[model samples]
Target: MAAAAHQADRPATGGQGCRAMTGGDRDGAPGDFRLTRRQLCALPGSAALLGLLGGCAFAARADAPPLPSDLFGGTTADPYLLALRAYIWGYPLVRAAQVRQNTTLPADPFRPRPPSAAGAAINRLGHAAELATPLMKQGVAPNNDTLYSLAWLDMREGPFVLEMPDFGDRYYTVQFGQADSSTEQALGQRTHGGQLPPVLIQGPDQQVALPAGMVGVRSRQRYMMIAERSLVRTPADLPAVHALQRAMRLRRWVDYAAGTDLPAPVSDQRPLLAPDTRCPAPLHFLEMLGNVLRDWRPDAGEARLISGLRPLGLAAGRGFRLEALSQAGRAAAARGLADAEAAVRAKTFTLGRNVNGWSVNYGGSVFGEDHLLRAAVAMDQIYVLPAEEALYPNARSDGGGQPLDGRNRYVLRFGAGDLPPVDAFWSITMYFARGLMVPNAAGIYSIGDRTGGLVRNADGGIDIMIQQEPPAAPRSVNWLPAPPEPFMVMMRLYRPRAPVRSGHWKPPAIQKIGGA
Candidate 1:
C-alpha cells in the first residue's frame, strides 16, 4: 500500500480497462511500457497489482500464473510485489549505470554507438563538438539547443577539481549526479550567476585540502556522472561553445596539486556491459542491481526499505544471489520485473499536467522517495533538469487527440505575444519515437525564438510548419521538417516563468491542416 499514492479524484480501481495514454519506450527495448502517478495510484489491491504484473507475463500461457507468495513468509508480501517495488526503487540507479557504462565503453566497430555518445573512458571528458543531429542517440529526449560534455568518475580515488570558464551571461549548467541517480550539485548561470568558481568534488568519505579560491562539494556516493550543457544559439556558435567546453577541466587532486603537465591517463577500467545490448533477463537485471548496490551504502530511510527486500534474494550490502531460489522463485521474480517494465511504460503519460495536448513533465532528477515516478521518468526521459531550471512540455498527438503522423501537415501557431515565457531561452524540437531526432533533407531538427531566418506575421505571431515536405515560399522559412512517420515534439523552456510552471499559461495546441 505504501507504493501507491492516495488521490481523492482518481478512482481506486486504477483505471482498469481504460484506454491508457502510453509514452515512448527506453532505448528501444522491445515490449517495454510506461506508467504514470495516477495509474500507479489506481492499482486497487494486491490482487489487482498482481493481475497487472502477472497478466502481462503469463497472458499466453494456459497454466495458472506463478504464485509469488509461496516464496515468502506468512506475513511478508508476495515476491512479485517485493520485486516490483525493488524494480521501481532501483531503476534510476541501474539505468544510470547502463548509460555510464555505454558512455565509457570503447565503440565497437560492428556496433555503431549513438553519434552523440561521450565515448570517453572513465575519468576522461568527452565533448560533443557540435549540437545533436538526427543520428545522435546518446540520451533520451536529446535537446538540440545545447552541446554536451560528459564524464564518469570514481570519486573514491580522490578529490577532483572542476574548472568553469567565464560564460558571460550564457545559460549553462554542470550537473553532478550520484550513482543512485540523485543530484549532488548543479553549478552554472542559474545558481552561480555570471561569476563562476572552481570546485573541488569528492565523495562523502573523501577529504582533501582545497587550493585557494576553490569551493568544496561532497557527494553521497563514490560513483559520479558529470553532464555539462552549454547553450548553442545557432549552427555557427558551435566553435564558441566548443571553446568553453575545452576550457572546462576535471583532474584528480594529485594532478592539480602537482601541476602535472600531461592530463592523467584514463583509468584502465573495462565496462562490463556492451552498447545497445538487449535488456537483461529479470534475474540478470536484479543481479546487476545487487552488484551496484554493494558499492553503495543506503541511508537510514533506504536501509529500511531495502531490508524488506531481503526475502526476495536482495539485500543492501550483499548482491542478489540465485543459488537458493527455486525454479518457481525465479519465475516469480521474472514476472515481477516484466510487470514493472510494463507499468513504467504504461504510466509515463501523466508525469505532470497536460494542457492542449502537451505534457509539462515535472520531478526531474530530484525524486525523493517517489520511486514509481522516478522510474517512469528514467524510462521515458532520463536526466531531465528540475522544473525550476527547465521545463520540457512535449506531445505525441494533435489537438484533436490523434497521434501525430508525418503524413498530415500541421501548424503550430503562436498568437501574438503568446510565446513561451522564460528567463533564458526556448526551443521546440522535432523527435521520432523514443526522442530520437527527426531526419530530414533540410537538416532541420528544431526551431524556436532563437532560430535564425524565422519569419513572423505582421502581428508578430509565429507559425511553425510541421510536415514531411517543405512548405512553399515565406512559410518555408519557419518549417520544422519531420520524418515521414509518426513523430513527437518537445518544447524546452530554460528558466521558465511561474506562469508556465503553474499551468496558467498553456502552449498553443498543434492544429492539423487540411489535405497536404
Candidate 2:
C-alpha cells in the first residue's frame, strides 16, 4: 500500500526538511518554485458543474451532457443497488461539498464550487472554546486547543512544496487528502521536528528533486488539500499561532527553481470549485460518484467493490448521463443508497470499544480505507487527526446512562490530577444531533482547561455546569452552554499522554444533576 510504503521510507527528522531525505528519488524538475504563495492555485468563485475526478474538470471537455431521466433504467422503480453504489463512491465528494457549503457558502445552491468570501471559512484563528464564533456557527465540533486553517489544492498544475515554520514545542500538523477525502499525507509532529522540512507533492510517477531543506511525500491526486492545525494554549496564544499560519506556504514546482522571488498568484480562471452539497438522491448522486471516480485511484482492495460500479455508468473518466440507465437498474440503485445509509449509521456507532459510556477508539477511522466507515465519516468530517495526535471520547448520556438534553442540568467533574490526560491541551465541545452546534444565550459552545475564570473544587478537581440557562454565578465560568433540546458532548484529549493512550484514564462520565 502507498501509505505503508511512504511510512517505511518517510524521514523521521521530526519536521526539518531535506535533513531527513537521502536524495529520495529526485526528478530535479527545473523551475520548480517560481510562483507567488498566493498563486499556488487560485480558484475562481464557481463550484464544479460536475466534479470530474482524476484532474478532469467537466467544462474543459465541451461534451458534458444534460441531466437525464431514470439514472439506471428508465422503467425500473427499485433503486437499492444504484443508491448503494452512489452512497459509497460519491461519499467523499458529497461530504466535502457538505462541509464547504455549510461552513463557507451562504448563497450558493446545491451544486459544487469554491466557497465565497475568497475562502472565508479557511484559516480561522480561534479563540477559547467558551465563546461561540463564526466558525462555530457553521456547526463544526472543533477542538479548542487548535486554530484550524484549510484550503483545497490543485496538485495536478504541478508538484508543490509545503513550508511551515518551527513552532517551538507546540503541536501542529498539515493533513492532506484527495478529492474523495482519502488520506494523502499527515506531515507534522509525528513526521518532522520543529524546523519544518519542505514537504513535496510530486507529479505523476515523477521523482521530486526536493530543493535543499526539502523532503518528499507524493500526493496521488492532482487536486488535494491542506488542513492546518496549530495548538492554542490561551486567548493570548492566538496571535502567535495566526502568524505561524500566515507563514505557512505552498509553492508551485516551477517557482521553487526560480531561486528568487516567485510570481504573484495567478488564477487558472478555471471555474473555482463549489462542491455540490445536496441530499443524495439517485441520478444526481450517481453523477457525483462518476466524477469522483475519475480521480480516486481505487487500490486492489477497493477495485472489486468499485468494479461493481462500472456496470452502472460509474466508470472513472467516463461521462455519466442518468438517462442512459434502464428503469430497473435505477430503481435498484435508489433502494441500495437508502439501505446503505441506514446500515452505515448503525455500523459507525458500533466502531471502537466503549469504555464507560465514552468510546475509547484508537484506529479504523477518518484516515483509513474502509469505504463504508469513510461514508459515515464523510457524513461527519472529511479530515480527522490520527488517534496518537488526538483522541476523542463522545458521550450521549449521563454517567447514569441517561440521554442528555437541554432540559436537564448536569456536571462532568474531574478528580484532582485526573483531568483528561494530555501533553498539549484538552477540551469538551457540545453538539446538537448530527454534530452541529446549537446556539445558546452565553454565546458559548465549548470549554476547556485554558478557558479563563474556571473555578476549581477545593480538592483541585473541576466542576463543569452543562445546561441551557446559565448556572449560578460561582460556577458560571465553567459552564458549557447547551441548546434547548437534545444534545451530545465530545471530549478532546490532544497529544494524549501515555495513560490515556493506553486506556488507563477513561474519561469520567457526565453525571446528571437533574433540571434546575
Candidate 3:
C-alpha cells in the first residue's frame, strides 16, 4: 500500500490472545491480569501500531520474534513520545493565528501596518515557531502543555494581544503553566507573592477591554499566564477566549517592553481580527502523513525525508501515536550509535572543536597528558564580566597560542580592583569538555557568591586555586579542583550592565602558575 493510504486507516488492533502475552501480569497471578480503563484505552492503539510495524519486519525474516514490549527497557522513551504527540498537536494550533498575524506585514492591504520594529520582533517569533517544531520532536518532552496552548491561543486571536508584564530594572524569565491559578500561584510564591491577580474575564461578564496601562508592579520580574481555561473549553468559544487572552497578553508585553525601552506595544482597542479558520484542515492531513512515516523502518533516505518534512508537518499540526514514534526514535538512535562506534574503531574520530588547545592524543588508548592545554581549554568556553561579551567564542587552537600548562596545580588571581561587576551575583562554573559536570577530588566544580565558605585575601583580592590537592590555610577558601583530564570554565554575571555586555572589562588569560 502507498504510505498515505496505509496511514489513512488506524492500525489493526490485536485481540485478547496477543494482549495476554505482552500486557499480562508479570507474576502470572489471576487477579493481576485486569487492565484498568485508562490502560485499555492506551493499549489498543499502542499494541496495534507496534504489531503492524513488527509484522512488516517478521514477514521479511520468518525467524524473527515479534517486537518486545520492553524494547527500550524501563526508560523514559515511552513517556517522552506521549508528550511529543501532545506537543505536536498542541503547539501549531496555539501559535498558528499569531504566526500568520505577525507574518502579515504593513504593505499588505489586508492587515494594518506593523511598526518598523515589528520586523525584528516578528523574526524572533518566527525563530521561536521554527524551533518549537523540531525541539518538540526531539526525545525530550515539554515540562507542560502551557507553551502549546499559549501558542494556539495566540494563533487564533492575534500575537499582539498576549502580554508579558514589565518587571522594571529587575531581570526576569517567563514560566508557563496550566490556565488555572495553580501555576500562577507557584510563580507568586517564588517571586515573594508578587504576581498579577488572575483575570479570567470570559463568558457574559467579559469586558470588551481597553489598554490597561502597566497592569502589575514594575519590580515583579516574573509573570505567569494560565491558558488551560481556553484549551479545555469547547472549540466554538475558542476565538472569543483567545480574543480576551490576546488583550491581556498585549498589555503585559507592552508594559514589559516599555520598561525595557523596547518598541512601544501595539494597541488592541480595535475590533478583533477575523479568524482564518482554514489552515487547520491541511495541517490535519500532514499529521496523517507523519503517522505513516513513523511506522516505516527508517534508512538514510527515509531519515532525511522525515527530517525535512518534520518542520512543515509539525507546523501543520500532525499527531503521531506515542508508542510508534518512540520505537522509530530508538531505531534512529541505534543507527547513530553504530556510526559513532564505527568512527572510534577506525581511529578516525575528530576531536570536538574545543579540543584544539587541549591536547587529546590517546596515550596508546590508555592514558594521555598535556599540562598547558589542560589549563587554557579546560572549559569549552568562559564568560568574563564586568565584560558582557563571552570571553572565548572560538574553540581553542593549538598553533594559535602557547598552552598554559597547569595540569596538577593552577592559580587564578583577581586583584581587589578586578571584581566582576553585576547587579545581582557572579560565579565561575567548571564543566568537562564533554559538557557533563566534572567530578573533582575536592568536590568543587564552581566558585562564586553561592559557594559557601569562600575566604578573601587580606587586601580584598581573591586568589583561587584550580588544582587536584587541598590548599593550605586561607588558600583553601579559593580552591576549585581540577579533573584528572581535560575540562572548561564558564563565568556568569547576573543583571549585567553595559560595561560587561559591551566587553569594557576583559578577564586575564589563564596562565600556568607552577609545575605539575
Candidate 4:
C-alpha cells in the first residue's frame, strides 16, 4: 500500500509522542538518553553489566543516539511492547480495509462482482445466491441460516440511498458498519418490524441534505461495509429470497436524483490476498495498517492512542517503512507481532461469561475502548450484530467440562418448553477447531427450529444428537454431524429477548452420551 499524498498538509507530529521517564540520572534534559531493557539484553555478556548496575545509579548521557520510544516515555524503549500496542489498536481497521481492497479493487473501482462470486466492489452490493455451506470457505463462521448480501461503499462523494422493499413476514437485517468494523446500525424486524424507509448514509465530513422521509446515517470514515442477511426458511424458498434480494437497491444520491440509478455493474478483480484469509506477515500487517490509517479519521480517544505510535514511525498518511527503524527495533517489532496474534487467539475463547460450558458473548455491536476485545471479535466473527439483534454462544467443552471431541457422541437436551427464547429464530451450527465448517457425508451443516422434520420427544423435550457417524431413525431427525476431530458448536439466537441479553438465560449443556 502506498502512502497518501496528503501527508504534507497534516501536522508533522502529534502531542509529545513520548512517555516521561522519572528517577533517571537525577535530571531531565534534551538529548538525555539511557539504554532500554531490549538494548541491554541484546549486548554480549549483558548479565555481568546488569549485576554491576544493580546497585549503582548512572548519570544520563547527552551522547546517546535517539532510540525508538515506548508508548509511555521510558528512558529505554521496548520496540516489542510498542508493536503489540500497534497491532491491537490497528487490527480491526487493517482487517476491514484488507477485505474491502481485496473485494473491490478487482472491479477497478468501477463495478461490482457477481453475487455468486466471493465479494462485491466498492459502492455496490453483491448478493449471495445461496446460503453458506461447508464448501463455502470465504469467511470465518459463515452462518447457514441466511443468504448474504455484501457491499463495500465509498461515501466520500455524498450520501448513498439504500432502499429496502417491504416484506410482510420475512426476517432479515441490513447491518451498516464503518471502516473500523464498528457496526453503526442494523435495520430489520426488531428495529422496524415489517417495513422500513430508505436510509441515506454519508461520511463524517459529508454535509448533505436528506430527501424527505429518508432516514439519515453517518459513518466515522469515508469507507463503509454493508452486510445484509435474509433468512432462508427452507431450500425450496431460495427463489423467493433471491427476488427479495434483487429488489434491494443502493445508489448514489446524485444518481437517484437524476434518474440514472442502475444496478451495480458486474465485474471481477483478482484479490491481492488469498481466498483463505490467512494471517499476513508481521511487517506486512503493520504496513497494511499504516495504509488504512492514512484515510481513517479516528475519534478523540483513538486519536490520542494513535499519537503515541508516532515514535515507532507510524502516523496517519505516512507509510510504515522498514528503513525507519534500527536493526534492533525491527527484531523487537517482529517478536511483538507474533505475541499480539497469539494473545488475540487466546482471548477469543474467553469472551463474555462461560455458562453451561458455553461462552455467551454480548455487546459485539459496538466496541468502545476495548481494543483487544474488538480485535478478537474481528478475528472470529467480523460483523456480528448486537446482543438484542443476535447472541452467539459457542462451546468447546461438554457438560463435564472436558474438551469436545467428535470421536465421542454428545447430546444437547432442552427441557419441555425451554427452547432458546428469541423473537425471531434459533440455530446451532457445527465447526472445526479452526472455526470453519467441516464437510460431512450427511450434507448437514446446521440444525435449527426451521429444520425440516425435526423431532421432539412425546413429553415436549428435545435431544439433539451430535457425532461424526449417522444415527438411526428417530435420533437421526435431531442429529448434528461433527468432524472426526476436535470441534466447537455455536448457537445463534436471532432477535433475542431481554432474558438472553441480560445473561439470565443459558442454553442446556452438551452431555457425553457414550459413543467413543
Ranking under TM-score, best-scoring first?
Answer: 1, 4, 2, 3
- Output the better candidate (3/4) by TM-score: 4
Lowest-lDDT window of 10 residues in candidate 3? Answer: 1-10
* Residue 199 displacement in candidate 1 (angstroms): 1.0
Q: How many clashes in each structure?
A: 12, 68, 33, 3
Q: In candidate 3, what are the lDDT values of residues 1-516, reduced to their tens digit? A: 000000011111122222111110011011122333334335323343344334321112212112234322232434223222322222222222222223323233234222211121221221111111111211111111011222212211221233433333323222232111112221221242223443222211223343453222111111122221111122243344334333344323333335542432232211112133221221222333343333233335324433443423321123332233344553443232222212221121122222323322211111122211221121111101111211222111112233322254665667787776665455555433222344555555556655556778788877877766778976787877755544444454544545555555444344456655
lDDT of 2 by residue, 63-174 (tens): 2122123332233223455455456546555555434333333353223322211132222211122223424323335444566655555455556666688878887777
Native RMSD of candidate 4 (Å): 13.1
As a whole number from 0 to 100, the lDDT of residue 285 in candidate 3 is: 24
TM-score of each: 0.81, 0.73, 0.34, 0.81
Q: Give residue 156's lDDT in candidate 4 (0 to 100).
A: 63
Full-model lDDT, candidate 2: 0.53
Per the 3 Å backbone cut-off, how many clashing residue pairs does candidate 1 have?
Answer: 12
Candidate 4's TM-score reads: 0.81
Candidate 3 has a TM-score of: 0.34
lDDT of 4: 0.67
